[model samples]
Target chain A: MVLLFTAGCRAKVSESPIGPSVQLHAPLGLPPVPIPPDNPPTEATIALGKRLFYDIRLSKDNTLACATCHDPEHDFSDPHPISLGVGGAKGIRNAPTLINVAYQSSQFWDGRATSLEIQAASPIADPLEMNQTHKVSVSKLAKDPVYRKMFTDAFGSKDVTLGRVERSLASFERTILSGDSAFDRFQYGGQPTALTPAQARGLALFINPIKGNCAACHTITPQYALFTDGKFHNIGIGVNDDGTLKDAGRYHETTVKSDTGAFKTPTLRNIANTAPYMHDGSLQTLEQVVSFYAGQGNSNPYIDREIKTIHLDGQERSDLVEFLKSLTGKLPPNLEEEKSHP
Target chain B: MTRFYSRLWLCLPFALVITGCKSSPPPPTAAPAKPAVSYFKVDPATAGSVSGKITFSGRPPARKVIDMSEDPACVAAHKGKAMEESIIVGNKSGLENVFVYIKSGLEGKNFETPTATVVINQGGCQFHPHIIGVQVDQPVEITNSDPVTHNIHPMAEINREWNHSQGPGDPPMHRKFVKQEIMIPVKCNIHSWMHAYIGVLNHPYFTVSKEDGSFTIANLPPGTYTLATWQEKLGTQEQQVTVAPGGQAVINFTYKGRS
Candidate 1:
C-alpha cells in the first residue's frame, strides 16, 4: 500500500483516484515496483534499454548481447552455470537468471559490487567476460545513427556516457521480473488440486524452521516470496585457489574480518535454471545444494556461525528439495525477443 | 515413650536431609549478574559533531570522465544506479570527494539520534553533495537515487564498517557510526574512480563545501575544539578554535596542493 516516490499512471504511480484504474497488468502479489524519482520507468527508457540489451553490437566483438548469457528461453539462464564470455573465456561463477532480480539486494556471488547499473558495466570490461571497455562500446554504438538517436532521446544529450549506458541496461533489466508461477496458485489461491498432497507436505517441511532452515536465507514471504533474504552469508564455501580461502568474498573487498568467507545469498526463484551453484559454481544440482545444507555446511572454519548441523531424515530432505524444484517459474516475457543461440 | 521416640527419629532424618541440601547447592546461581541493556555505553559522554568544507582555494578542480566495465552476464558485481559522485555535470575541482573524520577517540558516545536517518543519495551515478560532515554516533542512509544500482562501500577503521550494494527499488542502506573518527573514505567499486569523502567528528564542528568551496559548522557549546579539513586529492589540515555557547566560530586551514 506504500507508494514510495511514484507518479500514478493508473498503474500505481501516476493514475489519480479520479482516473479509471488502467487495466492493471501488474502480476498478482508483488510490492509496488520501486522507481527512482529522476528515472521513472517510461515507455521511452524501457524501449531504449531493451534495444541496447538485444543489440549484439554493444559487445566489443559484436558477437553477443546481454541475452547471450541470459537467454530468456531457458528460464533466463543459458543452462550452463558458468558461461563463456568474449574470446570464449569461462566465467568464474554461474550465469544467474534474471527472474525476480528486481528483489535482490546485491548482484554478484561475492557481492563485490552493488546496484544493477554498476553491476551491468563490470562484464563489459572484465577480461574473462564481455572484454569490452566503455570507450570501445560507445564508439561501436556511435557507428550506428539509429543507436545514436535512441541514446540521445533516452538520455536527453547525445554525449554517450557510461552512466547513460548503465542506466539503460539496468532499466531493461527491471522489466525482466518474474512471478505467476504454478506453485503460487497452489499455495495462495484456493486451487487445492493445483498441488498434490505430497507437494503440499513438502511445502510444510520446507517452511519448518527447525528441519529446513531454508527460509532463514531463502525467504518465503506470504506474498511474492522471492525466496531470498537479500543478505550475505559465508555458507562455508570451499577454500580458494591459492590454498587460502577464496576471494574472501565480501571480506576481500571490505576487510571487515567477519566477512571472511561470506557470499551473497542467491535467490531461490528459478534457481534450478542456473546450475552449478554457489560463488564458484561448484554444486551441480538442487539435490547437492540440499544435501550440503543438510550436512550443516561443509564443517569448515570460515563457515557462517548460523549454519548449524541439521538433522533431516531422508523423506524430509527429499520433500524439502521438491519444494525447491517447484519454484521454477515461467520463462521471462522477452525470451522470444532474445535471439536463439545455436 | 514410643510416640516420642518415633517423632525424634523422624526429626533427625529430616534435619539430615535439609543439612545435605544446604551443603550442595546448584552451581547455576554462582555467578554475579548484570542488568540487561540494548547497547553497552563507554562512559557518561555528551553528544558531539564534526563539520568542515572542501577548498580549491583559488580555482575549482578539474573533472574526470567516468567509464563503464564490459563484463558479461553476472560478470559485474551489482546492476543498479550510480552514486552522486559518478555523474555530476562538472567539477573544475580536479580531485573531489575528500573525506575527513577523527581517527581515534569518541567511541560509544551518548547522543540523541534523529527520528529518521539522513539519506546521502547516489543519484546521477555520483555522491550527492560530494562530501558529508557528520557527528560521530549518527546514522547515515546511503540511498541510490539513480535508476542504476549503486554500492555504498565505506572504508572505516575506528568503527563498524559496511559494504552493501543498493539495488533499484530496494530499501535504503542504513548505517551508524558507533565510534568517532575524523574521516572515512567512501567509494563505489563499480565506478573505480567514483569516490566521496565523509568527515565524522565527536563534536558538532564540521562542514563540507558547496561548489564554491565554502564549509561551516554552527551551534557550538563554548569549547576549544580541533577543527580539520580533508581533500580527496589533498591531505588533511586541522586548526584549533574556541566557540562561545550558542555562537559560531569560524575555523579554516590552507594546503599547498595534493600531497
Candidate 2:
C-alpha cells in the first residue's frame, strides 16, 4: 500500500521528450495528487488510458468498459443498486464512485487490491465482470494500429503488456479528482456565508462527536478533508434476519472473524450525486442512510464502536442531508467530454 | 569483550569519514556524538532489574463475547467461547497485556538491536499475544496459522504504516519499524474486531505484562528511569524508579474501574 503521508505530495509527470508532462494541480480542499513514481502521467499515457477506459474491446463480447459502471455523468458511479457486468451478470456490491479515489489507501469494498494498478486488472478477468483474460485483452488492443501507436507513445514501446495497461488506466483514474465545493468554501475558504443556515447547522452536527459522529470515520482534518478514514468497519449493513451476515464482506478476503460484515468506508465527496449508498447499496437516499446511522445501525456483534445511537429530529436529519449535498464539488475539466480515440 | 572491541575498531574509519565530511562545527544545541562502540554492554555485576505488578483496584469491565459464527473454522477453533481481550484481568486484579517499558532515561544509549525475530501468529481468528514490544529496526515476523487469509495492518504514526494480506500456507512476513513509537495499534481490516498493539522502543527495556500481571525488565544498567505502563483501554501511567546496582526495583501500579 502507498504510504498515507506520501498521498498528499504533488507528483509531477516525469520528464519525457515524447509528450508534454501534465502537471496535475489539486483543486481547493483536496491534497496534492499522488502520482506513482513509475507511472507518471504524461499526456500520451493519460490520453491512451482515457481511450482504453472507454473501449469496449477490453471486455469480452465487446460490450462493457470501465466507464460502463463508473459513469462519469453519475459522479463516476453506477446508478444501479449493484452493477451489472457483461451478459447481465449481477455484481454483489455497489460500484463505488471513483472521484477522489486517488487518495484511497486500498481499492474495492473489500479492499482486496492494494493499488489502483492491481485493482484495474481484476474486473477484466473476473467471471462476473468483464470476463476476459488479461492475455486476450492485451491481444485485442495490440490488434489495432491506433492502440499500437498509443501504447508506443505511452510506454516508449509498441508492446502492450498487462502491467502497462494497468498503469495507464490508473494514471487516468488519478485525474478524476473533485474538490472546491460549497462546504470547502465555508470550512476552508474562510467564507462563512458560503453555506445556508441548514447546511451550516448540518455541518455542526456532522462534526459533533455526540450527535452525528460522522466525522469520526469520515475524517476532516484542519487543512483538508478526504471524508474517509480509509479503514474498514462493519456498520451492521447486510445483516440477515437470523443475525448472520448476508455477505461476509471484508472477511471473504481476510478470514478474520470480526471483519464479517465490514466494508471499506466510502468517501462522502460528491455523495449527493452517487445514489444508493453503502457497500450493498441498500439505502436509496441520504435520508435513509442517515436514519440507518441514527437508528444505531442494524444490531450485530461486529458493528463498529463508532456507530452509536443518536437522536436526529426531522429538521436535523434534513439539515444533515443538505450538508451532504453541499459536498458536491467541481469535477476535473474535460472529464465528461468523451475522447473517441487517442 | 574482544569481539566488541574489534567491532569498535571496524567502525572507527567510517566514523572518521562522517566527521571529516563536516565543513563547519555543529550547532551547540546538537546532540553529543554517539559512542563508537558497536553496542552498549552492561556490567554483569552492576546490572539490575525492574520488576512490577500491574494491578487494577476496581471491578474490571466484563469481557464481551465474540461472535465467530460467520467463519465456521473460527467458530470451531474457539468452540463458541471466544471473548474480547481488551481488558484481561486475572488473579489479584492483575491486568494482563499491559505494556511496561522504560519510556525515558535511556536516551543516548545505543543498545544492539537483537537479531532474534519477534514472532506474532494469527490463529483462531485472533492475534496471539495481543500486545508485544520490539526494539527499533528489529524484525517482527508475522505468520498466519489459520485455514484462512489474514491481513496485518500496523497503523503506526512514527513508523511507516503498511498492510499486507497473508493467506494460509503463505510465508511469514518480516517487517521492521525504523522509528521509536510508544504504541502502534494494529488491526485486521478484514477482521474488524481483531486488534493488537506493538510497542517499539530503541532500547531493549520493554515487555508486556503476562496474564498474572507481572513484568520484568532485566539486565538494565543501574540508573533512575521514567517507567511507563500502557493499557489499551485504561490509558497510560508513568512513575520514577531508581534501581541500585545489582538490586531489583519492585514497583506496582493500580488502575481504577469505571463506576
Candidate 3:
C-alpha cells in the first residue's frame, strides 16, 4: 500500500502505484468530461493546482486568492453583483459560479478565451483581478522551495512558467464540477421521489416550447440537464436607458451586427446559490430573473428571438422560481487550508 | 430417328405431350439470345492518379478564435478555446482542408456510388472534418459527440437545404445530396463556430487535403481533365492536365497568403 499525503492529510492509495487519476463524479448522463491532451489530470498536477488555487502568493498583495471571490461556501461565487479585485477595483460582470465550469465552451462573460488555459492567464494579469503579471508571479514563485518542488513534480521541470501556471489552474478548475442535484436525482438518478410536485410542474413548464420555452436556449436533454446552450445571446440587459447598447457584450470580440448587445448565456445549474444574477448582476433575485424573461426582456432590436412573451400567473411564477432553485447540486469536497511553513 | 423420337417423347412433360396434338409449333430456329449490356468499368491499364500539395505563397491568415461563451458546454468540451479551420497553414506553409477534384473529365460517364456512408462528427462544438467530399446520392452521416445539442444546417444551392438538431444520445442524422453541388456549406446556428463544407460530385475522383497539405485522387481514366481546388478562404483554382494510361500526374496549387 502506498501512503499519499494531500492538503496536509495522509491518505491511502490502495489501487495503483502511479497514483489514482481523479475520477470526476459527473451527473448521470452527462457526456464524458473532456481533458486536454497536454494536461491529463494526475495526482501530482491536481495536488499542485489545488495548492495554487488557494495560494495567496498568486496575487500581488497576497491578501486574496481565487477563493476570495469564488468562495466555495458561496457555491464558488460571490454574493456581490460585481466582484472586487486586487485593490478593491470593481469588475464589470458578476463573479459567475465556477461550479461545473468544465462544461463551458468558452471562458468569461464575453467568451474571449477559447480554453481554460487561455482564460487562466487573463485574470492573473487583469488590473482588476489578481493584479499580478506572469513574469512577476513566476519570479516570485522561483524563490519558494515548496512551489519549485511541486512544479517539478507536476510538470517535468522545476522552472515555473506562465503556461504551467495556466495548465495547473485549469486542472484544478476542471475538477470543480457540481451535479447530483435533486433535479438530477429525479430526472436521471432513478429517484422519482427526489423532486417535489411543484418542481415537477416547473420542469414541465420550463421545457414546454409554447409555454415557458426556457429549454429553447437552456437545453435539457433526457440524460443531462446543463440548463444552458453555451452560446452567447443579446437579451436586452446591457441596453442603456436611452435605447442604445451599453456593454456591447460579444460584439467587442466578433463585431457582428446582431451580437452588438449579446453576452454569453450563464448556466442555471446553481442559479439559487449564485445570486445577483445576469452578466451585469442587474437582477436581485430569481423572481426578478423569471419576471424579466416572462416580460420578454427589455425591448431591444438585438434581443434573442427565444426570449418571447410568456404570461405566467403568480403561482406559475413561484413554481418556475422553485424549479430554478432545484438546480442547486452538491458541491464537491472543499480543499483544506494549507499549513504554514517555518 | 426412332431413338430421337423416343427420347423426345420420354423427356417432354406429360401434359405438354398430350396437348401437343392440339397446337402446331413453329419451325425451330436458333433460340433468341439476350444482348449483354456493358457497365462502366475503370480499365486499370488506362487508369492514373493525380497527386499534389497545397502550399501558401505569402503569410497565412490568422485563425479566428471561436467564442463558445454562448454555451458553456462547448467551452467545457474543449480544453481551451477552439479556432476556425478556414485557413490552416502548417509549418511548411501547406494549406489544409482544400477540396480537390476532377472538374471536367468524365462528365458524361456514370460511376457507381459507394454503398458505405460518409461520417461527419460534431465534437467539441466544431465539425470534425472541416472539408469532405461524397459521390452524388451517397449518404453522409452526421453525429453529435458533444454533450450539448447542435443544430446542423446545411445551406445547399443545387440540392435541397436541410436543418436538423441532434442531441448526444440521439441517433446520427443521415443525409444524401442527389445533385452535383461542388461545395455545400454547413453551419450549426446553435454554435456559430461550428461550420463545415461538403463537396458533392457524381464521380469518385475527389479528395480533401490533410493537415500536411497533401492530397491524392487515384483511379482516374486516361484523359485531359480540368482539376479544380477549392479552399474555404482562398477561392477555387483550375488546372488542365493530361495523364498517360497507367501513369501518375503531379499538380500543386499555391495560394497567396493573407496576413
Error of 3 at B128 (Å): 59
Candidate 1 local Cα displacement, residue A242, angstroms:
11
- Go through the candidates in order and give each one's C-alpha lDDT: 0.58, 0.80, 0.75
**Per-residue alpha-carbon lDDT of model 3 for A75-105, expressed as tens digits?**
8888888888987988888888887778889
Scored by TM-score, the top model is: 2
Predicted candidate 1 versus true structure: per-residue lDDT over B1-259, tens digit per residue: 1222133223433443444455544355334485221221212133223344444544433344343432221123235533334222224432334443333232443333222344577765567556666655556667776544444567778865545444444466556776666567877644445567666655433444444344444333345666555665566676776655444555444444433
Chain B TM-score (each prediction, in order):
0.59, 0.84, 0.83
lDDT of 2 by residue, B1-259 (tens): 1232233334534544554566465465634585343345566688898998999888888999987655555666655578899999999889998999898888887776666667888888898768878778877788988765555668888977655555556577677888999899988645566789998888878777877788888777899999999999999999999999998999999888875
Ranking by lDDT: 2, 3, 1
Candidate 2: tens digits of C-alpha lDDT, residues A54-111: 8889899999999898988799998898898889999898899999889998999999
**What TM-score does the first chain of candidate 3 have?**
0.91
The digit string of per-residue lDDT tens for model 1 on A13-97 reads 2111111111213354445555544445555456666877777776778787888888776566666657888878887666777
How high is each candidate's TM-score? 0.50, 0.54, 0.53
DockQ of each: 0.01, 0.01, 0.01
lDDT score for residue B199 of model 1: 66
Give candidate 3's iRMS in Å, 1 decimal.
15.3
Total residue pair clashes for candidate 2: 1
